[model samples]
Target: MQIVFLIEQVVNGLVLGGYYLLIALGLSLIFSVGGVVNLAHGAFYALGAYVSVQLGRHVGFGAAAAVSPVLVALIGIAFERFLLRRFYREDPILGLLVTFGLAMVAEQAIRMIWGAAPLPASLPAALRGPVIVGDFLFSRYRLLMLGVVAVVLGGIWLLLNRTSFGRVVRAGIQQPDMVAALGIRLQPYMTACVMLGVGLAALGGALFAPITTVHPAMGAEILTIAFVVVIIGGLGSFWGVVLAALLVGVVRGVSVHFAPAASEASMYVLMFVVLMIRPRGLLGEPIEKFER
Candidate 1:
């Protein structure tokens, strides 16, 4: 019985971590290559959930999922062009303040449009039951969510590691001046990074909406968790985000099972321990920007 329970918990942790991975990775992408402190990333997340839920009623969940992220991504790209681009060479605090203000505006707009009530989002009927593996069972929706996250993450890995553009992104991150001097336009790539990050944030929010409430404040709540994961995993490390998310998810799951009251606190403890051991994070390179 004990072993079965533990196995079940492990699966649950993986699924939960998938949700965290989506959010944290997006934030990392923006922070790393976009050179913007995007505090409003969470707002784009809320926008995705709300847009998907509202649009899903008419067009179906699958279509909504496909559409919401693109729309949110466009919004992010626009914001980058209109507002964030100005601060690229300025102090990081300037970007932070602008994005923070944007966050506030987004929340207020959401509250006004959606009202203060928590809207409910339902899982598709096809995903209502559990999938049994041996003697253990996992929620079908959660399993599906996990699969979706895995595919998305894999695609992201390919995008960053396989393509010609990926090489440009990698080189650009390390040597922006050199890339520009080589006649490769970095401005377009920066916009692309912001769009990609915002879109991923939206996708994460939409995927988790059926499991959690579609509320105005949901962005802030999830952002808090995602922020911690990024900090623990390292500011801009891809693999670090993946590993830290899984660790945080597993920690939260085990804590919830063993000590319900300390589920979130467990992640904090883990963060504290990891930071003490390696100040740059598990797989993170020391970021001069962070030190500044």
Candidate 2:
């Protein structure tokens, strides 16, 4: 019985971790490539969820799921080209402030469009039921989410480690000026990074829409936790983000299962402990003068 309970908790942890990974991966990429904190990332996430729900209601679940991320990515590209690009050569703090303002604007815009109420978002019929594994039963949608996240992480890993674009990104992160001096246009790469980040955030929002309430303020609520994952995982390390997200998820999941009253506070506590021990984060590189 104890073993079964443990397995169940582990499954729950993975589901939560999958969502966290999706959000944190994008944040990590943006930070590493663009040096932007992107406070409005969660807003993009909420936008994706709202759009997905609306589309799902009109067209169909499959079609909505397929198109929502593309639309969100286009929005991200617009933000990158118009707003984010201007701040690339300026102070990082400026980008932070701009994104924070954008986040507020996005939240209000969502309110005006969707109202403050939570909307209904249902999973596809194919993923509506639970699957039994040994003595425990797990939600099919949760497992599907896990599989999607795994595939995404693997794809990202391949993109970063096995592709020429990855080399360019790494070089830029390490030496932006040198790359620029070599005649490389850093603007396009940065724009791509923003799109990638926002797309991942959108994906997370869409995936979680069926499980959680879809409200305009939902982004603000989850942004803090996503930031925590970024901090704990180390700002620019993709693998670190994944590991930290999983750790945070497990911590929160176990807390929810064993101490429901304290579940909400556990992630914060974990973040505090991590920061106290490793101020630079688990896999974060030290910021050099060039990076600044």
Candidate 3:
């Protein structure tokens, strides 16, 4: 029974990890391609949830979820063009400070627009129940969320590995100077990268709104966890983020079951241990820009 219970917790953790991946993977991709640590990434996520909820009230849940990310991606285009574009090759600290400032501004905007109160979100009747698979129970909505994440993951993998756009993006990450010398403009690609990154973050926010309270500070809350996943997975490696997210999720879940007091700190502890052994992170690749 104890073993079964642990297995159940592990399964739940994987679901949680799927959510983590949605947010963290974008952060990693943005940093990998554009060399910007988008502290404001979570703000896009909060916007997604808030927008989805508002749209859901009128358009219904399915349409809202489908459309929210596209809306956020549009916002991302403007953000990259006007704000992030200026700091691309500047001092890294400048980019960091700017994004950090943007995050604060976004939070305040949310507070002003939505008020400081938390918004409650609900799923469609079809998605509100649980399923008993073997002796374990799972949220019907979560399984659906997991499936969506998997599909997104597959699509992204294919995009990066199999497309001409991906080839340029990959080259830009490793050898921007060389790509530039070839007469290829990377600015457009960077814009698309930001769009996709924030769009994924928004999708996470939209899908997760029903399960969690939609609040002003929710973006800030998730940002911390996303950073952890990124750090653990290493920056430029796609699979590293995926692995770290799942590992962090399982560790947190198991810790909650066995040692409630340590649940919150478990990932941090794991991070510390991993860093002690491998400072570059698990499967972290050397980034060209950062090398200098």
Model 2: C-alpha RMSD to truth?
1.5
Measured by TM-score, the strongest candidate is: 3
lDDT of candidate 3 at residue 191, scale 0 to 100: 94
**By TM-score, highest first, what's the ranking?**
3, 1, 2
Q: On a 0 to 100 scale, what is the lDDT of residue 279 in model 3?
A: 89
lDDT of 3 by residue, 1-292 (tens): 9999999999999999999999999999999988889999999999999999999999999999999999999999999999999988989899999999999999999999999999888999998999999989999999999999999999999999899999999999999999999999999999999999999999999999998989998999999999999999999899999999999999999999999898999999989998999888898999878988
Better of 1 and 3 by lDDT: 3
Predicted model with the maximum lDDT? 3
Candidate 2 residues 144-188, lDDT tens each? 888888998898889878998888888888788898899998888
> Which order, best to worst by lDDT?
3, 1, 2
Give lDDT per model, in order: 0.87, 0.86, 0.95
Candidate 2 wrongly placed segments (more than 4 Å): 289-292
Per-residue lDDT tens digits of candidate 1, residues 1-292?
Answer: 9877877787788788888999999998888885676889889899999999988999999899889999989998898899988998888888999989989999989999989898889988897998888998889888878888899999989999999888898887777778899999988888998899999999988887888888888888888788888988987789999998998998988888889898879999999999999877888876554555
TM-score of 1: 0.96
Q: Each model's TM-score?
A: 0.96, 0.95, 0.99
TM-score of 3: 0.99
